[model samples]
Target: MNRKNFLSSLLTIGAAGPVLAAAATPNAVPSVSRNTAASSAALPTPLIIPPYLRPGDVIGITCPAGDITAKEILPATQLIESWGFRIKVGETVGKKDGVFGGTDDERAADFQQMLNDPELSAILCARGGYGAVHIIDRLDFSPLANRPKWIIGFSDVTVLLCHLHTNGNWASIHSKMCNSFPDDWAKAEAIQVECILSIRRALSGERMEYKVPPNVRNRNGRAEAALIGGNLKTIESLAGTRSDIDTAGKILFVEDTGEYLYSIDRMFWHLQRTGKLDRLAGLVVGGFKVKPDDPGEEFGQTVTDIVTARVKGYGYPVCFDFPVGHQKDNYALKYGIPHLLDVQEGAVTLTDTSVPAAATPSL
Candidate 1:
């Protein structure tokens, strides 16, 4: 979609309602929040973030993707602090009017400033609501190229990840940030601590293996591949553009939140139709918060059902309910790390390839 239509779509989706969509099945009726298990008997381990985080690292929080709920800022900062890093809230952090976050110029500026800031160890987004596409076109990554650090967020920020992976960093994370972090950090401080520490490990080149919540039913094939993906909409948007992800032979992890089951199907359909979904050696679905249009048809085919329909015959292992989306218990995954995914005997273990420490940032 061109920038004009992209902007229009944002307004349209928002004017309709806040996102709370779920996949609906014709006969199944159940609470939407109930997590659906992956239909595949086993799954693979997700890629780990490069461990570059340290206690005193200065992290920059910017609003490049979407407008954050203004009220959530202070508390979000507290959550970042709870993880032990100080945050520099950008001038555009809370930029939002109706849906576009900030004026294209404003959002672009926030990203530009952070990319240029040498002191900021990483620039994390405040949210990913239908805006990054607008600003990405205007960005000049000279600063980012000079001082390479983590640029984190999911959903819309996937655009940034696509560009960064191809042109600059050779690494980044399609993980959580901003409003998404607080709820987790405030409660599971240690988990938050581990997450930060884990990212640090990935970045600093001290890679061993990160945690993957044990899955009883995982894809049994053991293979190594790169970690890549964010919201389905964002990834799908990359279709046809130069930044379209090359999923061929990679472990593709996909997740999204607040999408209608049909919309979810449509996005994946784009992937499938475009041959993007066909190349993956394995597929790991992140948390899906699917809502049905008709209350009577709650599990309208279910998230798993749609997933199975799209991926079942592809010959690659498919795992569902894996952590990588807009869920509270999502995992922090490195977008470019290579690791082993073993779904054997109903267990998924993501083992690192045992490479030397990750290269230090150029600047």
Candidate 2:
């Protein structure tokens, strides 16, 4: 379908009028209407991690995005098994044709099998490439809603995270993916385990605290909103699609890698024209990895400078150098989870119980 009709059809979903927040830029992040914050809603108390995996519980692994070979799976699976969970490799785990792990059918099939397996306690992605989008629509999530598990990953994985939150409203993790662990990154693997444990604690009604770094353009004095945004390009591509999210009154987290400063500016401009930045409650940039080409084109731009210009008119809180995005020890975040963003004191806190603890009991 052409982008115009494609978006028009999406806008007319149901009685709840189709909410469209951005109009001018077709490539910018699209907008959606946000529900008002329930100050007394008691905020998210920690998330409930699924039951601890015993030696027999299965840890499902699939390559919904990139392709993986046995080499890619062996070490990763060994690590999971070391944690005592049985490894359930998906059919599409190693089905690669080119850069993608497998065809859309094969990839979606793998995810479907894992999602439907009642014995799998948590499903982990082997890697994050670009194939997830191919199967995102092909797979059914009804089974997943009935048996929600710790679906984890970052980067392109953010696509699934947003869809899961926006469509099924499932709370998932935005932590490191399996690829983050190479043969030598065992220490990295150890940190991932710690992150997984936190996921478990969060799901089991235990809260985790985060240290919000000081901000230069800190805008919100005392405002809190749900956390969202990862891999700026990925998030920007979702605009005008069902996967897109509303940013109003939300802590907008952004980060990018291997992107020219000019490209970053264009994306931000696209975001502005679409109103994604203007309607946001605040802006927080994760480590914006800007690497210039040899004989540098010299765009005379920095990620921080580009973001500031795009968001200056909004006057919401803006923070930078946050330990997120393509970096080690990336901060963990609960997409769609309500959070408090304080600019004056330079701290943002995520409420432990946005979804009542009772509603999401210990897995």
Top-scoring candidate (TM-score):
2
Stretches > 4 Å off in candidate 1? 1-51, 69-71, 79-84, 183-218, 295-300, 352-363
lDDT of 1: 0.61
lDDT of 1 at 128: 77
lDDT of 2 at 42: 23
Query: Which lDDT tens digits does candidate 2 get at residues 18-81?
Result: 3332222222221221324322222222222233234566778888898778676786677667
User: Deviation in angstroms for 157 in model 1?
Assistant: 1.1
Query: Worst ten-residue run, lDDT, model 1?
Result: 4-13
Clashes of 2: 20
Over the stretch 1-363, how does candidate 1's per-residue lDDT look in tens digits?
A: 011111111110111222222222221122111111212211122221323667777888888766776567776677567667778888886667567667888888877888778788788788877877776657765443234467877788888887655432245766666665454445666655555444445544455454355454445565566656777878887787645676666667888888788888888778888877765766777788876577665546667778778876566666666656776565566676665566656455554453543633211
Query: Highest lDDT: which candidate?
Result: 2
Model 1 TM-score, 2 decimals: 0.74
Query: In model 1, what is the error at residue 334, expressed in angstroms?
Result: 0.8
